[model samples]
Target chain A: MDKLNEILLNYADVDEIPDSASFRKDLGLSSFDTACLITEIRTVMGISLEPADFIKCKTVGALKDYLNTK
Target chain B: MIEKILPDGSKVTAFPISIPQQFMFFMSAQYGAKYPVNNIGLCCFIHGGADLEILRDALYEAISRCDTMRLRFTPDEKYKILQYITPETEMNIDIIDMSDIPLEEAKLKLQSISREDIPTYNCEIHKISLIRFKGNTDGIFMRLHHFAMDAYSTGVFLRDASEIYLHKTKGTAYPKPMRPYLPVLLQELQYINSPQQTEDKDYWFRSLSEADEPVFTDYMLDNRLTQQQKKNPSQRFADIHSGSPEAGTLIFSMSEDESKRILSVCEEKQLSVCAFLSMGLRTALSVFNNNETDVSFKMIVNRRGTVAEKKSGGIRINYFPMRSIIPGDMKFADAVNEISLIQNDIYGHCSLSFWDMLIERHKSMPSDAKPDSTYDSIGLSYQPPTEHIQLGSSPDEVIWFNNGASMIPLYLTIKHRTTDGGFDFIFEYRKDPDPVYDLNIFFTKLRGALLAGAEDPDITAHVLLKQLKITDEERKGKNNG
Candidate 1:
């Protein structure tokens, strides 16, 4: 599994995971959880990310795309 | 009835203390009389082109406006029963000239002054003093026994004082007077004795009967890190003197933008800021203690606006134990939902007093089943937004210096300033000769967890445990070994 997917699976139901699934709406993730995800991505991907950056990526696909850019 | 008429023609009312104040009085008596347990001090710096005389008059006006400001507690014939007396006389405001002293010295003097304990045997319930520095800054100091007022009352007093000062200085009309606590206390007393209160007490009794014993003991005992310290020679030597603990406070703040983001995230998740912080705290404790899932701590809730409490303030707060069992395999979102539900249930019956809950628990459960008062040594409190009082057009900057002893082993107070929308986290902990945990690391981890949680709402507790390299089985195995 990709790093993002692995992190998401720990928090969200596997059945709920989809490329277009919204982290906030579909996954029911809190801001704190989102923050932890960003921190994990920073550590795993070796890049700095801000809250605004993650906040802009509403879906799993969007976040994945953003991570690729980094 | 009128206690006494002041020379200034203000009427004084004598009334019985509320149930909450009675609880504090009893607790103080039970704990020893050498030190006041819940005395709180608030000191703030005033920077503006303001005169000392005008500020003094404003302080006097504030005292006259709020009965709590003039409130005094006298012991009645009943043990630990205090009668609330609103003396009509003008409250003395001591003005000291620190104009020649250096700013650092002035601050040290203020700190020393704030730490001074109130003479419980005295007739006065509170004190207000001021210090004038050489620079444009002046200081307003207030020290009050918990029986006299609470944290909310401090805001009310400041707002009133500032309004009175503005009216005196700029000829602005003072806001309409708020109803005093005397009549409110009387009403509260009647309500507490009513059938509704009895029902609430029953609800609390049932809740306590079903509540689990605090899981903190388990975490403290099972954590490998704390256990490893037992082998250290210095730590073993210092443990002998750990009984007598000195209390210290650590204050931290987050910028406006950070606070706003966290708040917005909380709103998005349908969780209150208090709930979010509580979760962060639980997660931090869990991770710190080998990913222990069962987290328990008492959360102090303000009951001022609640039905059982008096709308006018004089110690309307209660501590309720918040217990959450976040399974190591549980998703973070699921844990948040579970906590939110539990919080809702607890808040529904929050009007029940902590003392009453203790009494009920002791009475309802067998000796072996009854939980001890070990849970009382840690608490979390969140201060709601209050009116901001500015000294000048630039807006008044007030920095709170807490000098009182910690009520618990660890008490965390989260306050959001209305003036700047910033967050202040004050962690007051007992400073023992042999500390079990490093508070600096604890605070840093908690803050990091909160910030990380806010940044990535999709991260599960399991993932967090993995990322932080925490393994519960390994920790437990070490403990067993």
Candidate 2:
């Protein structure tokens, strides 16, 4: 699986996430769950994303765009 | 309450006390305000060929013989909890039999049922079902409320129940309630006001200042008391069997030489085996936590008196925290001796309540923090060998509660039965954290520490490196062979 898809899959029990859906709204992720997702993303992408960075990215597409730049 | 004189001519006060109320007060307070509303009842699941009528008749007569069994709670005018003193009475037993249903499946159903429906005041003695295992005679499963009876008392009740059941089967009057826990309860109450109370209070204060409050959270374990909740049975069993690799019992089967070495160390230092073990564990855990400073947790006191006098056996089960400050770099033997002196000086404190300490120091704690932050550690208990007393029936092995993820995070319990030649070391992690991962780490470290202690009684932080010797040997063999 590609990096983004793998990260999304590990983040939720549900199999798929829509491109249009925000991570928090679509996945119903708690703060701890969100942190876990970020930690996994950092490890996989080898990028340092501060906790504050997660605030701007709401949806899968937004997160993907941000990750690609970093 | 009446005044009486002890054999030593010391004045002792006795109470025409409320037995059930006392039971309820202690149990509810001790077990965190959940289950067995009164906190002193049994959840006995008995199975037999006999129908509901036989079970009811047997239970009725059994409760009748035991007057205290019918004792209930009543509040005094002051509303300070008091027991309703009842005249010796025979009460009808409430028995529920689901024998017509399949046995194994019924057990699962009954176990799945929550306490929400059961009457809080009354104890449950469910007639779950009769078991017909291929190899042996039949047996029934039972769960008792801690408030009604402890393990020892429960065993007696079961033994008596069995005797009564057997006699009834052959058509005989049920035997009398053999031994009651009431006297023990009464004796323990005495300590509430005794010199022991002062010591217990002090210990509680110190422990609370150091430890933290119990935080309740969800446990990762999928094992729920619901029929719909299911996991692969084999996997569940495997997890339980492995226990936390680091957490449960760490036994050190001493070679004759090693045993003698330990004895010599204890004798030279005038320490008990239990005291020595406590110091060892503290040192090991301190190192595992990477504690740059020394810390201490509560240790269980059997409350049994010394050999010459029954000083310890007033039926009160008490534990108190005795702290020992370790030099960040102290050797193992020195640390062990430090524990011995601390224990000796504060042995009197064990009888005090750990609750008062937190209340006294509540101001120092963060106002926003919930209770239990005062102490972060729990007591470790050890039960010495005693002649097995045959209670109502032979006692089943006691199981420890899987205190799922916790708020306070860590508790360690060490209990052993000489009769059974078995010992258990339980580490309770605050389940509120990632319980599975925290426990996985905590148990592994604790187990390593305990095993290291066993191999070298005089183990120190410096000597911990020696524990890798086992792996080293394995590796060497692999290379040579």
Candidate 3:
């Protein structure tokens, strides 16, 4: 699993997170969960992203791509 | 701070208290230990069908796994608070079935169960129970000392417990373990003397020092403060403060649609809901005091910058003054944007102890001057929506019990309702007056201003005051029409 999925796994009950799964819709993450995810990404993945930017990413695939580009 | 072998063959190790913990002690001393100033009473009813046996096992598993559940507060001759983790086996869970009683009576029974406080100096940290309510649903009543857990951590504990319960019920694998608590504690201790601490101290000192002493901005529509001041000449201090720490709560829940409207506006502007709410509050404060441009209030900054701290359970709150001297001509949008910027700046330096800095500032005050407590009297804490556990049809049905005591005069906490992501404004006020009618009026004004500002960001705050000044009868007539 990627670092993103690894972090998501900690919060979500799912064993795996598909890149297509959107945070709020599919994964059932709350705004607070997304906020915590942003904090984790900053620490674990060394990515600096605001909550707004994260919200802009509609799905996990988009976030992964955004991080990869960064 | 020490390690010793008890005569009973139990080993005990002690850790120094954090700044938040120190503040809890300070407040408790002022409130008198009988009040249990740190106790937080929370009673939540779960709607879904949860097997009692399975839930009990899950509670055991969660307690065994989460180090936060093991924390105990014990003070020795050396320190006022020395915390240590107890064995998970030491936890005692109560299962109460109040189904036999009427709903109202059962609620009272549950409230009584949730209202118990941890002894002031003892290590008996919390009380957890599984209650069967009148509707055949299970309720979790928790009496947690603020020292061991905060609002965020309460969410974490419930989330984890639900996860464990699901894993057991569905025959799936147990979820990922929470980060260890000791490392987080040690990291906080290191921060006390670090470079970041120095920077934070300097920033806060500069921030508070720049603002002039703020006037009391009463949220009550009745102008309770003004009336009380006029009635008692010498008790003018009561106008700006609450003489007693005993608190009563007034909860005002906003509709899901209204909440969504605010959330949409926040997203469109790329603003945190907290900032928007802060601006709304600051605008109302200004409006209440003849459009007082210089307004300040204590804003809660939870130092959960790192994932470890965010995931772990403990109190790491830094309540500092969010001083805003808004220009009379500034647009509501611009004001909110400025508030958000200040929040971001302060959040960056949140690890420092605001309480310590506050004490230091007090020491610098003149001998005869009473320490101005205006900023703290009116405060706001916006809670981020953490992972939620469902016990009912809609998780928003959860009911919170009062601790019967509070440390502040006026505190407003904005929480997201889990059912539909709506807003729950819980106001904890001093025990003296029942501010329900005025509190409702205050929210109506704040909500109107917020909605109006969101609709037209360019609207100046001076214009927003019109909403605040709207007569209750007129507002009702407008609603009727």
**Candidate topping lDDT:** 3
lDDT of 3 by residue, B1-481 (tens): 5784444566788788887777777777776656666777776677754687788888788777777777876656667568888776565787888888886897776566555656744455777888887765777777877878888887777778888887877765566777778888887877877887888778767765565545456665555546656765433222345456667888888899888888888767666678899998887776656677877778887666445666678888878767787886789878887887677666666666756676645544434336654433478998866657564555625577777776777789999887777889899887765555666667777777788877888888777776567475844643454
RMSD in angstroms, candidate 2? 25.5
Is 1 or 3 the stronger prediction by DockQ?
3
Global Cα RMSD, each model = 13.4, 25.5, 5.0
How do the residues B1-481 of candidate 1 rate in per-residue lDDT, one tens digit apiece? 4254344554444456676777777666654544456577766677653677889888887777777766665544543344545557456888888889887887777666666767664367678888787677787877777887888777777887888898888898776565567666776677766886788788877776676543442223244324535664222101121233346777778788888878787767655566778887787677666676767777787755321222255777778878788776666556666776676566656666677776775664434333443433358888755657777556566655555455456778888765686888887766653223344455555677777777887778877766654345534544554
Which of candidates 2 and 3 is the stronger one according to lDDT? 3
Task: Give each model a TM-score.
Answer: 0.74, 0.52, 0.84
lDDT (10s digit) by residue, model 3, range A1-70: 3777888876665667888987765775644455556777898888888765676788899998888778
Q: lDDT for each of the candidates?
A: 0.65, 0.44, 0.72
Model 3: colliding residue pairs: B1-B14, B46-B391, B47-B391, B47-B392, B48-B391
Q: What is the CAPRI rating of model 3's predicted complex?
A: incorrect
Worst 10 residues of 3 chain B by lDDT: B233-242
* Candidate 3, superposed: residue stretches over 4 Å from native: A1-70, B5-9, B120-123, B211-213, B221-239, B360-368, B391-396, B470-481
Question: Once model 2 is optimally superposed onto the true structure by TM-score, how far is the C-alpha of residue B299 displaced, in angstroms?
Answer: 3.3
Q: How would you class the docking of model 2?
A: incorrect
Model 1, stretches more than 4 Å misplaced?
A1-70, B1-13, B30-33, B171-173, B191-193, B211-214, B217-242, B306-311, B328-334, B362-377, B392-395, B417-419, B433-437, B468-481
